[model samples]
Target: LVVFLFKQALTWIFGLLVVEKNLISYPYRLFFKKANKANFSFEYFIYPGLCALFSLYYPKNKSNLLKTLHFFISTSVIVIFEIIAVKYTKLIKYKKWTWYWSFITIWITDYVTHAFHKWFFKTKFHE
Candidate 1:
């Protein structure tokens, strides 16, 4: 729950920033339609849910190679969806943003969130 909320907050802020900068846009929004350009569902809900799942299932005791693989796979999956959304849907449209940018940011933020999660429950999480 903590990790979910934390990721939600982080993504929410960044999402708004990206939209404000015209790097991304959402033609259809489920919330805050008249006041915000960001997609509330994806930023505040889907992404946080994904981050929570990623952090919870991270292979903490695994080898470095496996850990890297985990990050690659998770980020790739997300990028794939974003690419699809960009190509086929009005839900998200990239202005100055690219798929690689999504990949890089997701990778970095997920790493940070995972680190925070581990630190917040240090004794409970073991490598």
Candidate 2:
């Protein structure tokens, strides 16, 4: 639950920013009909779940380069999927957003969340 909450917190923060600023949007979603096209459900659940999974499986003791590579690959795949979705589906519509913006944001989000996860667990467990 903590993992889910942590990721959702980050998601809400970043997700609200882009949506409220009109940088990106989701015209179709399962819930939150009044938040414009922000897709708050995705931010609050699906994405946070995925990010929590990433954190849970992350190799906390690995070298920095390997960890960086993992983040790059994970975020790049997401960006590629976003590009394909943008081309083939109505899942997301970018106003001033681009692929790089998604990549950067995803990377930073993962990095920040995972770093916190590591520190939190390190201090609280196996001591």
User: Model 1 over residues 20-62: C-alpha lDDT tens digits?
Assistant: 9999989888798987788888888899999999988899999
lDDT of 2 by residue, 7-126 (tens): 888888888889889999887777767755577767787778878878877766899898778788788877888899888998889999999999999898888888787777775565
Clashing pairs in 2: none
TM-score of 1: 0.94
Query: Cα RMSDs of all predictions?
Result: 2.4, 2.5
- Stretches of candidate 1 off by over 4 Å are 124-127
Q: Cα deviation of 78 in candidate 2 (Å)?
A: 1.6
lDDT of each: 0.91, 0.82
For model 1, what is the alpha-carbon lDDT of residue 71?
A: 94
Q: Lowest summed lDDT over 10 consecutive residues: which window, candidate 2?
A: 118-127
